[model samples]
Target: MPNYTLLTRQLEALLDDRDWLINAAQTCAFIMQQVPELNWAGFYLQRQPELLTLGPFQGKPACNPIPFSKGVCGGAARSRQTQRIDDVHAIADHIACDAASNSELVVPILRQGTLWGVLDLDSPRHGRFDEVDQAGIEALVEVFNARTDLPDFLSSH
Candidate 1:
C-alpha cells in the first residue's frame, strides 16, 4: 500500500498556488505519478447543474459532459458521495473511456457545501482501492479545497 500520509504532504507542497485549474491539473498528475496500477486520474467539473464537464486529467482521452443520471462519476456527483467500484464492467451504465480500466474511485469535490466537481481515479487492476485509499483520497481532496480559491462562477470562455 502507498503511504498516503506522505502523498498528502507532497500534494500540499505541490499546490503552492491557489489557482483552481492549475492545482486541479497538478493533482491529477501527482496522483498518476505516485499511485500504482492507475490507468487514469482526472477531474470532472460540474460547470452546470447536474452536469459534469471534463477537466484536467493525466491519461488518454476521456468522456465529457456526463449527466447526474449516468455512470460511476455521475453517481458520485449526483449523490455527493465517494464511489469505489471494484469492477467497472459490472456496472450497467459504466462509461468506458478506457477499456483497460477495471476499477474506479470517484471523490466528490465540494466548495463551501456546494458541489464543485469530482476527483476521479481509474485503475487497470481489479479492486484497486479500499477503505484506506478512500480515506486518503478524501483527505487529499480536502487539502485541495483548503488551498484552492474556487470561484462560484467559472466562465468557460
Candidate 2:
C-alpha cells in the first residue's frame, strides 16, 4: 500500500493550485497511479438536490449523473457518511460502471455538517478495500473539506 500520509501531503500540495477543477483532476490521477489494483478513483459531486454529477475521475466512463438514492456513491451522499462494500454484487443498488468492479468505497465530503460530495473508488477484486483504506480516504476527504477554496463545480448545487 502507498504511504497514506505521503499521499495526503502530495494531495495537499497539488490542491494548493488556484484552479480547483484542475486540482481535483490531478489529485484523482495521482491517487490512481499511487494506489494499486484500483479500477476507478474519483469524485462524484453534488449537482442539485438529491443528485450527484460525475466530476474528475480516472476510469472507464462512469454514470454521468447519479441520483443521490441510487448506488453506493449515492448512498454515501444521501447518508453523509463513509460507505464501503466488500462485494458490489451484494449491494442492492450497485451501479455497474464497469462490470469488472467487484468492490467499492465511498467517503462523503462534509462541509459545515452538510454533504458536499463524495470520494469514490472501485476495485476489480472483492474485499479490496478494508477499514484501513476507509480511514485513509476519509481522512483525505476531511483534508479537502478543510480547504476554503474548493471550486464551485458542485458547490453551486
Candidate 3:
C-alpha cells in the first residue's frame, strides 16, 4: 500500500499551478510515478454531453471519445460515482485501450454539482486496487479539486 497521507501532502505541494490543464497533467504524472503497477493514469474530460474526451495522460495511446453509456469511465461519468473494478476483463463493455490493463479505478470529477470529467487509473495486475486505494485516491482527487480552478464544463447543460 502507498503512503496516501504523504501522497496527499505531496500532491498539495505539487499543485502550484491552479490551471485545470496543468493540474490535470501533473496529477496524471504524479499518479503514474507514485503508484506502483499502474499501466495508465489519466483524465477523461467531458467536453460534450454524454461523452468523455481524452485529456492529459501517461501511458500508451488510448481510446478517444468514450460515451457515457460505455466502458468504466463512462459508467463513472454517467452515474457520477467512483468505479473501481478488480478485473477489467470481466466487464463486458470494457474499452480495451491497453490489453495489458487488468484493473481500473475511475473517479468522477464534478464542479458545483456539474460533471467536469473523470480521473482514470488502470493497472496491469488484477485486483490491484482495494477500498483503501479507492479512499486514498478519492482524497487525492479532492486535493486536486480544492486547489485547481476547474472550469464548469457542463454549466450550460
Candidate 4:
C-alpha cells in the first residue's frame, strides 16, 4: 500500500516552493514513478469555463484540451469530485488518448469549496485504482488545496 501520509507531506513541501504548474507536474511524475502498474499520470486544468486544458503530465502526449463533461478528467472537474473508473473502455465519452490505458482515477482540486482543476492518473491494468488509491489521491488533492494558491475563479468569493 502507498504511504499516503508521507506522500501528502512531500506534496505539501513541494508545493510550498514551486509554482502551481511545476508543482503539479512534478507531483504527478513522482506518483507515476513510485506507483506500479500506472501508464499515465498528470493534470487537466480548468483554463476556461467548461474546458480543461492539459497541464503537467507524465506519460504519452495526451489530448491538448478536454471538455468538462467528456472524459474521466472532465467528469471529475464537472462533478467536483473524485472518480475512479475500473475500465475506461466501458465508460461512455471515454477519450482514448492512449488505447493502452485501461483504468483511470481523477481527483478534483478544490479551493474554498470550488473546483479548480484535477489530478489524473491512468493505468494499463484493469481495476488498477480502487478505494485505497482514491483515498491516497484525495489526500494528495487536499495537500494541494491547502498548500497551493488557488486560481482566481476558485479563490474569489
Candidate 5:
C-alpha cells in the first residue's frame, strides 16, 4: 500500500499556489511518479453539463469529451462517487482509451458541493487498485479540493 499520508503532504506543499490547473498538473505528475504500475494519471474537467474534457495529465493520448453516461470516469462524475474497476474488460461500458489499461480508478473532484470533474488513474495491471488505493486517491482528491481554486476554470468552461 502507498503511504498516502506522505503523498498528501507533498501535494499540499506543492498546492500553495492559487492556480487550480497548476495544482492539477502537479498532482497528476505526483501520482504518476509516486504510484507504481500506473500507465496513466490525469484529470478530466467538466466541459459541458454532461461531458468531460481532458485536463492536465501525464500519459499517452486519452479519450476526450467523454460523456457523463459512459465509462468509469463518466460514472464517477455522474454518480459523484469513486469507481474502482478491478478489470476494465469485465465492465460492459468500459471505455478503451488505452488498450493496455486493464484497470481503473476514478475519483470525483468536487468544488464546495458541486462536481468539478475527476481524478482518473489507469494501469496495465488488472486489479491494481484496491480499497487501499481508492481511499488514498480519495484523500488526495480532498487535498486537491481544499487547496485549489476552480472558479475561473469552471466558469470559463
Candidate 6:
C-alpha cells in the first residue's frame, strides 16, 4: 500500500486551494492514482434528502442521481456508515455502475453531523478492500469532510 500519511499530507495541500469542486476532483484523481486494483474512485454529493448527484470521479461513466433507498452508496448514506463489500455480486441489489467491479468500499461523509455525501471506490478484483484500506479511506474522508464546503451542491428541500 502507498503511504497514507504522505497521501493525507498531499490531500491537505491540494485542499489548500479551497475551491471545493476542484479539490473534490483532485481527491478522486489522487486516490485512483495511488491505490492499486481500483477501477473507479469518486464522490456523490447529497443534492437532496433522497438523492445523490455525481461529483468528481475517475473511471468510466458512473451512475448519477442515486436515490437514498438503493444500492451500496445508498446504504452508506442512509446509515451514515461505511460499506465494504468483498463481492458486490453477492449483494442482491448492488448497482453495477461498472460491470467490472467485483468489490467496493463506500464511506459516508459527514459535516457538522449532517449527511453530506460519500466517497465511493470500486475494484474489478474481489476482496480488494480490507481493514487497512478502510482505515486509510476513512482518514481521507475526514480530510474531505473537514475541508469541503458542500452547500453549493445540496438542495434545501
> 11-121 in candidate 3: lDDT tens per residue?
999999889999999999999999999999999998888999999999999999999999999999999999999999999999999999999999998888888999999
C-alpha lDDT of residue 9 in model 6: 84
TM-score per candidate, chains pooled: 0.96, 0.91, 0.97, 0.90, 0.95, 0.94
Q: Write the per-residue lDDT of candidate 5 for residues 1-157, one digit (tens) a residue.
A: 6899999899889889878889889999999999999999999988678889999999999999899999999999999999999999998888999999999999998876788889999999999999989999999999988888786355674
Whichever of 3 and 5 has more TM-score, that candidate is 3
Q: Kindly give the stretch of ten consecutive residues in candidate 6 with the minimal lDDT sum.
A: 148-157
lDDT of 6: 0.89
What RMSD, rounded to one decimal, does every model reach? 1.6, 1.8, 1.2, 2.4, 1.3, 1.3
Over 1-157, each residue of candidate 1 has an lDDT whose tens digit, in order, gives 8899999999999999999999999999999998889999999988887889999999999998899899999999989999999999999999999999999999999877889999999999999999999999999998898989886654553
Clashing pairs in 2: none
What ranges in model 4 sit over 4 Å off? 153-157
User: Candidates 2 and 6: which is better by TM-score?
Assistant: 6
lDDT of each: 0.92, 0.82, 0.94, 0.83, 0.91, 0.89
TM-score of 2: 0.91
lDDT, candidate 4, at 30: 79
**Which lDDT tens digits does candidate 2 get at residues 1-157?**
7678887887777677656577668768987998889999999887677889888899999987899879899899988878899999998888988999999999887766666678899999999988888888876766666643565444563
| C-alpha positional error of residue 54 in candidate 3 after TM-score superposition, expressed in Å | 0.4
How many clashes would you count in candidate 3? Answer: 0
Residue runs of model 2 more than 4 Å from their true location after superposition: 151-157
Model 4 lDDT on a 0 to 1 scale: 0.83
State how far residue 61 of model 2 sits from its true place (Å): 0.4
List the candidate 1 regions with Cα displacement exceeding 4 Å: 154-157
Off by over 4 Å in 6: 155-157
Question: In model 5, how large is the Cα lDDT of residue 137?
Answer: 92
1-157 per-residue lDDT for model 4 (tens digits): 7888888887777776436766777788778877788999898877677888888889999996898879888899888878899999999999999999999999988766666788889999999998988998888877766666556553343
The CA-based lDDT of model 1 is what?
0.92
Best-to-worst ranking by lDDT: 3, 1, 5, 6, 4, 2
